[model samples]
Target: MNKDVLTFGVEEEFFVVDRDGHLSPAGDAVVDAADEEEGELQQELTRSQAESATGICTARDEAERQLTALRTDLAEAAARRGCRLLPSGSAPLAETVLPAITPNPRYERMSEHFGATARTSHTCGCHVHIAVPDRETGIRVIDHVRPFLPALLTVTANSAICDGYDTGYASWRYQQWNRWPSAGAPPLFGSLDHYESIVDAWLRAGAILDRAMVYWDVRLSEKQPTVEFRLGDVAATVGDAVLYGVLIRGLVGTILASEARPPKLSNEVLRAQIWRASREGLSGRCPHFRTGDLAPASEVLDDVVTFAAGALAETGDLDFVRDGCARLAAEGGGADRQRARFEKRRAAEDVVDLLAVRPARD
Candidate 1:
């Protein structure tokens, strides 16, 4: 595989809030402001949310720079409209009205099909897109990387609160998202043809209306020539997002280099692993994909990092990833930070405030 295959991009969704720190349906205003400034922003399923995507980047530092610029520009644009931007996984405060759907035909069809799930779903997430040599490599990447995705979610956990109360789970957004018809881990496919056949079967069976509804944690991008990872929450800072991008590219590179095939785990076990990761985050044990043995989440994460060390080093991202992981473990992840703020102030709004800013580094 060409080393350039490691090129990647990130997309992050954000919540739009009013001055009172409550979810607000101001996505249009913010998007218009962003458009005037030539920012790469778009409306989401709900009018209360917006998303931004970074251009293709080859280095971790370049990815971080693009993400930081997007976050800063979007926040400033939202502020100009008297609405605040919160890069939180879920809305912090309760909302009385359903957010309006984005004015597009496909989103309209999605709303009609999913009903309340579309209107009430205000969760945000960060998706990583990594380049591959071809369709075969993309299929191979998604298959081989499936087992490790749960542990990746443990690191990006961020939604600890919802509707002014603690949800008790580290990433409530994952739980909410799992409610979709085809939203969990995908089954292993032997070839790119097999993958497309399964997708075709789903569409014909009405399990999904279109290709876009195939919401597996990882999938071949229908719109691009890359494998898309849709597992993690929107990171709380640019650094965290960059860390995720680096680690994903490293994992992909490692898998491609080894020329390994995916192991067959029952769908039941895969779903169980995903749920456990979301529920406990990094505070509990994670089930090892190969051994089926449980270990502390931190230890499991360390093993993952160690497994990809060579790839990370080759990309010149080893030191940054090592330091970033250490910092996350020490200072706590987004969910920990949100819970700490709520615990200290006894107010969910303060958590929203903290989510709005780039968290102070330890």
Candidate 2:
């Protein structure tokens, strides 16, 4: 990422599960290429997975190379230690009962702080970050891009089935996430001061245990100058990750260059849409916040791509976005495939059995 080039890097989370779908702790021993001799790949807030962060990557090839390398290292480490790394949103029903945090001070603090809610099962998500020029632009980009959040959520939809049941949601992770107090959509900020005013107010009010509670579906990354969208359930496949990354580039640039203001979706309305999408996936009906049109998830997503073509081209990803989306159209969404796989075998075990970590091919 550089000041001169508009660029992005990707971060992803996976559920480390045993063959039986039981949650497997990454522990302190899971090795990573970047780790010191004594340390390891960083454990997530939940110890069910270990995260390997890629070095800042500018072009698509470099991002793909580094991500593949990191995932390969992690897969080898997890296998050597007797567990499997699976990219997914929530813990499958078969593994939902296991609960224990790995040994760490920060995890202990989180357990003490979040209490009952912190024990929830795994759900992976991809976080795509473009390097921002400054905090002001970061906030500005997020604010300007809020209208497109639901569409981003739709295109990346992959969790229509959960446990042994059809949760009847497109992305069940959204349903699971909405339970957290600080989660859901962000507030529409008239200015950066208004956004800071709220954060400062929360600190002054002692509302959050720390700044991490700003769990709005999308936010400015606290440690870096970038707008981060937490809306996607980590894609179940690498292709889905690339698709999401492509959409983020198009949507961010589209908003930056357009006259459109972020849609002012009320908390109630926003939650309703999130719940609807989670339950129905692309087949479910959801509101178009910009036009108030209620349509199926598939229809709304098409509109998102069709509307952003100019911006997509301007960002130099027009063909990439078109080809990627066409691929989705031909394949059916991830949810559709998972659900179909279950129907074919008449079992959730079959679907979970298909969940796995993909290696970079030789």
Candidate 3:
């Protein structure tokens, strides 16, 4: 297997809502569709929503092709029933509380464990999975990729806006996740064994249900031969998701290709910075993981993009990175856009209607 070559798969969460905009449990709908291979690409998780996953693809076009089809089927199904499938990292309405069951045993159990930690809104997230050749390679990738997680999050913080409110944070989903124990950044690990050792401690601590439930912003998957990045908020369109997909692959590849110099951090301080980034998004300061210095979030992103040039160039995605950053600057990213829309429309319905505009993938 080529250790240096990396590929990705995308799994996006979508809100399944009824005509009244009430959240619906769609785990059975999604999983059953997967079973028939006929509808929404199946995902195993909590139901008031559904997931559209991709077949492993070597290129962005292929990933988009699969994602588009999957979301279309799911959206059409929901629309047929006078419902809408919306992608958000978390539900925008803090008061819109719903049951968490998804009809899957894994989800049922996982929810029981983390439900206490999750927020009440219905938010969706874009989880990008990168291939890991085997156990050893997987461990190495996890060990080396910690510090860069913030740079990755800042570049893709689409949840800056959700529902009709600004929520005063960039990626509110991270802020939501921080409510649960064992759901934030992990301490830098020196080796796979060391990583697992921490997992073992969590298992023994009874704080986590399994190694798979560790919920790090970036974590090695327990079942898949890959790393799962859970940081990004659900992007509003396929273009946004793909743009992010390209950047994630580049970041991970850059880390894996190097001499394995682990990006170090002091957990307590770093965790505090993580909260600030989650709360402020790009508007406030972010922790510089490497130098442990304070800098504007934009400054932090500028440097990370520079460090990521080689990988982005090799993947033919450097332009996407540069352009995505420029677009964020011009548009103020998701949070800014969300706030502007709310200010203009003065209504959540209009805000969502605007977000529902499906951008053509051309």
Give the best candidate by lDDT.
1
TM-score of 2: 0.88
Q: Which residue pairs come into collision in candidate 1?
A: none
By TM-score: ranked, best first: 1, 2, 3
Local accuracy of candidate 3 as per-residue lDDT tens digits, 223-277: 7898888877877777778877877788778877798567556677667777767
lDDT of 2 by residue, 42-158 (tens): 677676776655556555556666666666666666676676677667665455454577677867776777777666735677778776777777777777766667767766677
lDDT of 1 by residue, 132-194 (tens): 879898888887887897789988889988888999888899988877887878888769899
Show where candidate 2 strays beyond 4 Å. Answer: 1-3, 31-41, 204-207, 359-362
Q: TM-scores for all candidates?
A: 0.95, 0.88, 0.87
| Cα deviation of 268, candidate 2, in Å | 3.0
Cα lDDT listed for each candidate: 0.83, 0.68, 0.69
| Highest TM-score against the true fold, candidate | 1
